[model samples]
Target: MARQHPEEPTLVELTIEEVKAMGKQGIDHPSTRPVITGGVVGAIAGAVLPVVTWPVGLFAGAAIALYTRVKR
Candidate 1:
């Protein structure tokens, strides 16, 4: 008869730890895509709307995207 091996338990990281890890990774992190996409979308919107500048829109979009990613 074949012997069965027990499965190991998985470790879950806290939200703060995950954020710290991502921060260490910086722009090279997986979250870069969403941030960049948000920046682009914001820039486009800013261009369309005369009130907001492209740079301001870009920063706001990136911040929002990063917040959402970290919260997840």
Candidate 2:
């Protein structure tokens, strides 16, 4: 017959606020300022640019938003 060993318990170090704040930066962080700026710029550009360029600007703005969020 074999004897089994007991397992040690692990401790988690995160606080409630820190845990709540985790992964929350993507939309509301300061780093996302560029994304907001990009969106506004894209809107203005879309209004003035050709119909084809309007979509391009919007996509570019979305790219900027993703870039900022990923970089952060």
Candidate 3:
């Protein structure tokens, strides 16, 4: 019989924490500067593009945010 370590976190919990940490790291990255750069870019794009179609601007904002996080 195998023993289950009571003090150990389950695989799922560890995976969740890892994912959360990755998100935090992405947000904290220097290139994006999520609060100032990403947010401002996204907001501006969203405001400008929405004139054509409401959802389009929202999608553009989301893409900008993603690009900011992924950009070097």
Candidate 4:
């Protein structure tokens, strides 16, 4: 690897902490569903739901996974 700069990374080399902070910056946290996961699920659900409108299929699967909670 090349020498890391005294200055921060220009476009690349963003640290995980920086990335996470950037990801959730200025937003309420402890979210029930992660933004990324929720986004992916929503995308899949929206794409697939129209073709196969089954009662227990892709859209429902994603919805259940995102929404269901187990009781203690």
lDDT of 1 by residue, 1-72 (tens): 999998643223344554576689977878877888988888877778899998888888876776677666
| Alpha-carbon TM-score of each model against the true structure | 0.61, 0.42, 0.32, 0.27
The residue-by-residue lDDT of candidate 4 on 9-34, one tens digit each, is 53323333434663676345332344
Off by over 4 Å in 2: 1-23, 26-28, 53-56, 65-72
Model 2: lDDT of residue 12: 27
In terms of TM-score, which candidate is stronger, 3 or 4? 3
Clash pairs detected, candidate 3: none
In lDDT terms, how accurate is model 1?
0.74
What is the descending TM-score order? 1, 2, 3, 4
In order, the Cα lDDT scores of the candidates are 0.74, 0.58, 0.54, 0.46
Error of model 4, residue 64, in angstroms: 13
**TM-score of model 4 relative to the true fold?**
0.27
Query: Best candidate per TM-score, number?
Result: 1
By lDDT, the best candidate is 1
Provide C-alpha RMSD values for all models, in order. 7.7, 10.2, 7.7, 12.1
Cα error of candidate 2 at position 14, Å: 22
* Winner by TM-score between candidate 4 and candidate 2: 2
In candidate 3, residue 4 scores what lDDT?
89
What's the C-alpha lDDT at position 57 in model 2?
81
lDDT for each residue of candidate 3 in 1-72, tens digit (9 for 90 to 100): 999867877555654554466578775654334434445555666667645453555556554554545442
